[model samples]
Target: MIYAILTEAQNKQEKQPDMADTVDSSIAVAGLKAAIRVASHGSFLRAAISMGVSQSQLSRRVAGLESRLGQKLFHRHGRGVALTDFGQRIMPRVQSLIAELEAFDALVSDTRAQLSGDVTVGVIPLVSRHLASSLVRRLQSTHPGIRLRMLEAYSGQVEEWLSSGRVDIGVFNRYGGARPVYADPLMRGQVSVIGTPDHPLFRQKDIPFNVLQAIPIAMPARPNSLTDHILGAAANHGISLNIALEAGTSSLIQEAMLASGLLTLSPAGTYVKAISNNQLTARHLCSPSVQQTTWIATSRQHPLTAASRAVEKFIKEILYTSTQ
Candidate 1:
C-alpha cells in the first residue's frame, strides 16, 4: 500500500522482507474466526456444523493459522482437541478482536440489518440440558448468521438477566402478573418422578404424590419453582414428603439418584431421550398432575436487535415443536 510516489525503484524490492507478514495479515481474519469457533465449541466438527461450513474448510483455516504462527495451536487426542499453550496465550486477544469486529459491523450496519449479531440467552438448567444441542442445530441450520451465547441458570437468575438487560432472551415460567418482560408461551412440560426402569413404580400409569415417601425420592431444595409446587401440593394432601436429599440443581438431583440408587423428581422433558435409551423413567403424578408453562421472553425495558428477534422466533418454534 502506498500513499505517494516512491523516490526510487529500489523501494519496491525492499518490500520483499515484509511480503510474508503482509500475506499472514491478509489470511489472519478468516483463520482467527475459524480458530475461535473451534475453541468455543471444543470440537472442530461441531464448530463447522454450527458455522454452516465444511469441516475440511475449517480445518484448513486453522492449519494455515498455525503455519503462519509457526506453532501448534491445538493438541489432538481421542476425545477431542484442546488449545495448546501458545493458543491459550493468544485466545483472549483473539476473542477481544472478534468482539470488536462484531461491534464495528453492528455500528456500520445501523438500521439496515444483515441479521448478523450475537445474542446472550438465559435458559433454565433442565431446559438447557435437554434441548441445547438441538436448539443450536436449529439455529445453525435456519439462521446461520446469528451467533448464540447461552447462559444456563435457575428461573430466578434467568428472570433477573432479562430484567436487567444482561441477556437478550430467556426461557422462563409464563404466569405472573405485571411482569417486567414480554413473554410468549412456549409449551407446558410435566413435573415428574424420575426413576430407573427396574423400579416397581414404573408399572403404575400415574403415580400419586402420596407414594413419594414410599420410595424415598429426592426433591429439589426449597426456593425453587418445582419444590414449591410439590410442597404446596403435599401440604394440601395432608402428606409430608420424607425428603432423602435436598439437591441444589436438577442435574445434581438426577446424579444423586443415579449414584445412590435413589429416586428423584424432575421435569418430564429433561430425560426424554434417556427414557427411550432405558437410562431413566419420568412418571407424572396423578393426584396433582403438575406441569410448568414455559415462555420465550425478552425484556420490555431492553429493545431487541434484529438478530435477537430472529433468535427469539427460532427459540419459540423449536421449543413448542419439540415438546409435541
Candidate 2:
C-alpha cells in the first residue's frame, strides 16, 4: 500500500509542470539559505558569523535571493532585522527544504554503509608493524560492521599477493629497485641508519660512507628490500657494504639492531616513536640519505571494497597529517 501511494505521488510530481519549474528554484536553496538564516538570526552580521561568510557577502546573497523572489524578505530595523510577511510565509518551506537536504545526506550515508563489504589487505612486513596496526584499529573502531583480514608477509610475498586475487590492496616501499606494476607513491619516508645510543657513530656529526660501510649492519635480503637499494648506492660509489645479518622480517631486524649493535635502516615515520622512546638512535645516512617511497596498490583484477577504500583513505589521511 505504501509503495503504491509513493509511486502515485512520484508520478503526480513528475507530471506537474510547477514541480519541474521549482526544481530550478530548489537548486538555488543554498543561496536562499543565507536569506532565511539572516531573517531567522535577526541580524546579517550574526548570520554571516554563524555561516562563516562575510557580512557584506551574506547581505548581498540574501538581497539577490530577495530580488529573484520579487519580494522584500527582510526589513532593516535599527540594531536588528525582521522577516517581512512574505519572508515569514516562505520560511516554513525553507525549513522544510533544509530538512529534506539533511534527509538526503543521511540517505547517502546509509547507502554507503549498505555498500560496504569485507576486505583482505596484504601489507608488507615493513609497514604492517608500524602503519597497519593503527590503521586496522581505526577502521574497526569507525566501522564495526566491516570485516577486515590482514595478510602480513615479506615484500616479495606481498607482490605475489598483489598478482593473485588474494588481497584488495598492498602497501610496499619502493627503494629505486624492481618496481611493482600498479604501484604509485602514497607517501615519502626516510630510511635512516639506526643503532643504540652509545654506538660509536651515534654522536658523530658526519660519518664518512666508507667508514660507515665497514661497520657490520643488519639489512634485509635482496630482490625487494630498501636495504638493497642502500647497498646498491654504496656499491655505485665504490664502497663495499659489510652486512653482518640478513633478515626477512623487519621486527627481527629491529631486534638484531638493538641486541647486536648492528646498524639497520628504518622508515623515520614508522620508527619515530621508538626513537622518542630512546629505544633506537636515528642518524642521517652520510651524503645521500636512503629515501623511500611507500606505495598502495590494488590487484589488477580485484575491485576495491568499501571497507578497503575506507581503510586506504584513513591511511592516506593519517600519513598526510603526520608528515605535515
Candidate 3:
C-alpha cells in the first residue's frame, strides 16, 4: 500500500511539475539538509560549525524536521548521535535527491563564470607531496578563484572522508580488492626495491619478491598502505620479512636506508630524486610486480561543486597524460 501510494505520488509529481509545490518544499529542503549535515558530522555542534550556524539553531531545525515526520531521527549520546532506523532508511534517498538538485543548479549556472569555491581533496600519505605540488601549481595558474585543501591521510581515513561526505574527491591505493564506492583508476603506483649503490643488490635490474625475506630492510610502521601490502604479500608468500628498522615516518625510513645498507621498498616517486643523485639504486619488483592501482574516489552522496569538478577534470587529464 505504501509503495503504491509513493509510486502514484511520484507519477503525479513527474507529470504536474508545479512551481508552487517547489516553493512549498523550500522549508522541507532546508530541514533535510540541516538533518543531513548533522548526521554526516555525527555531532550537532560540529555540523553547526561547519554550516556556519549555531548549535541551538541546528537542533531546532532537526527538531522541526522530526516533528514534521513524526519520527525520531537520532539516538543522541553525550558525544554524538547516530541515525535512528527510520532516519537510516531515508537519509540516502534524501542525500541523492539533494545531490541531483545541486547538479541541476550547477548545470544551469553561468557557463563562463569563474569557478570559486572550497574543495577538500584527501590523498594517501605516500602520494601527498607529489600530487599536492602538481595540483596546487596547476590550480593556482588556471583556476585562481578555487581554494583547494589537500588532506594527507591513510587510505582508511580517506575512505571514511568519502563515506561521511567530508571530502570533495580523494585518492587511494587500490589493494586487497575493489572498494564499494565510485572510483576512477588514475594510474598504477610503481613499487621499487631500493638500496644504496654500495650494496650487493645495487646492480640488479629486477628484484624478486621472495628475496625480501632475506634482505635487511627499513619499512613503514603500522597504519600505512605500503606496510599493509607488504605484510599481506609476506603472509601469502609464506615468508617472514627481515624488517631491521620500523619507522613511523618515511623520512626516518629513508634515513635508515641511507645510513645503513638497508634495502627498502618504496613508490617510484619516493626515491626518484635520490636515485638520480647517485645515492640509491632501484629496480622494479618482478615475479608479479609489487604495484598498487591508484584511484580517484568520490562520494555518491553529494554532487561535485564547480571547483571540485574543475579539479577532478584537471587531475584526470594529468594522470592520463602521465600514463601516456
Candidate 4:
C-alpha cells in the first residue's frame, strides 16, 4: 500500500512540469501588442517611441511572439523593416483579435453602474478646431468618468481609423454627393472661394463658379478630396483653373493667399476665425454651389461601449446646438 501511494505522488510530480511548460509557451498579450505596434510602424525604433518603451524591450517582446508562432515576422533592412509574407497574412486576424479583446473589456466595464472608460474619437481638422474644446468641456461636466481622447486628422485618415477599429467615432466631410450609408450627417456647409480682405472676389456677396477660370487660385495638392472636388466641378462647368500654388494644407493655402494674393476654394467653416478677424474673407460659390456635409461615423466592426455611446450623444448635442 505504501508503494502504491508513492507511485501516485510521483505521477503528480511528473505532470506539474508539463503544466508549467504549457503556461510558459502560450502566446502573451503583451507580446502580441508589441508585434502589432512594430508591424504598424515598420520600424522597431519608431514603434518603441510611439509605445513609450525602449527599443530593446519592444524587440524582445516581438521576438518572443515570433518564437511562439514559429515564424519570422519581419525582414530587417537598413531602412527599417517590412513584414514577412506570413506576418502580412496573419496581421489582419491579429488586429481583429485585439479589437475583439478591447470590445470585450469595454463590455465588462459597462456592467458597472457608473459609465467609465476611454473613448477615442477621430475628426478632421475643421471639426477639431471648432468642437474639440466644447466636447471636452461637455464631457467633463456631464460624464466625468468617461475620458475623451481626440485624434485630429484628414478625412481619409479618420476613415481608416474608423475602419480599423482604432477610434470609437469619426467626424469627417463628405463633399458633393449622397451621404455614405454608414455615416450620419451632422451639418452641411458651403464651400467658398477664400482670399485676403483686400481681394477683388469678396467685393460681391457671392462669386460665380465660372469666375474661377480667370482667377489664379491656391489649392491643396492633388490626391486630396477637396482638390478632386474642385477639379470635378471645373470639369462639369467647362472652365479651367489657373492653379497659382499647390499646398499640402489649408493653412499653407491661406498663407499663400495672404502673401501672393492667391485665392483658394474651401469650406466656410475652415476659415471662420480668420474671416471673423478680417484676416481672410470668404465668397460663397454660386450657380452650381459646392457643399460639404459633415458626418459622424462609427465602425461596423466593433461594438460601442456605454462610454462611447455617451460621448457620441454629447457630440451630437454640441453639433446641433452650434449649428442652431
The candidate that achieves the highest TM-score relative to the unseen native structure:
4
Off by over 4 Å in 1: 1-111, 129-131, 138-145, 174-181
RMSD of each: 17.8, 14.2, 9.8, 13.3
Candidate 4 at 3: error in angstroms? 69
Q: In candidate 2, which residue pairs clash?
A: none
The sequence of per-residue lDDT tens digits that candidate 4 reaches over residues 1-324 is 212322333344335546654444333556777888888878999888766679999999888877767898899988899999998988787777766665655555555558888999998767687688998888788778888889976676778888899999999887898556467789999988899989877889999999878689987777667778888888988989898888766778778877988888888778788889998998899887988989998765678878888788788888888899
Find the 10 residues in a row with the least total lDDT in model 3: 1-10
Residue-pair clashes per candidate? 0, 0, 0, 0
Q: Model 3, 116-214: lDDT tens per residue? A: 989999887566776778888998998798999888765667888888989989887766455433577887766888888888765678888887776
What value does the lDDT take at residue 54 in candidate 3? 88
Q: Against the true structure, what is each candidate's TM-score?
A: 0.59, 0.60, 0.62, 0.63
Candidate with the greatest lDDT versus the true structure: 4
lDDT, model 1: 0.72
Q: Give the alpha-carbon lDDT of every model.
A: 0.72, 0.70, 0.75, 0.79
After superposition, the stretches of candidate 4 with alpha carbons farther than 4 Å from their true spots are 1-111
True-structure Cα RMSD, model 3: 9.8
Task: For model 3, state the Cα shift of residue 234 in Å.
Answer: 1.6
TM-score, structure 4 vs. true:
0.63
Candidate 2: tens digits of C-alpha lDDT, residues 198-282: 8988787645566775789887776656766777789888888788988877778788877888887666555565678898887
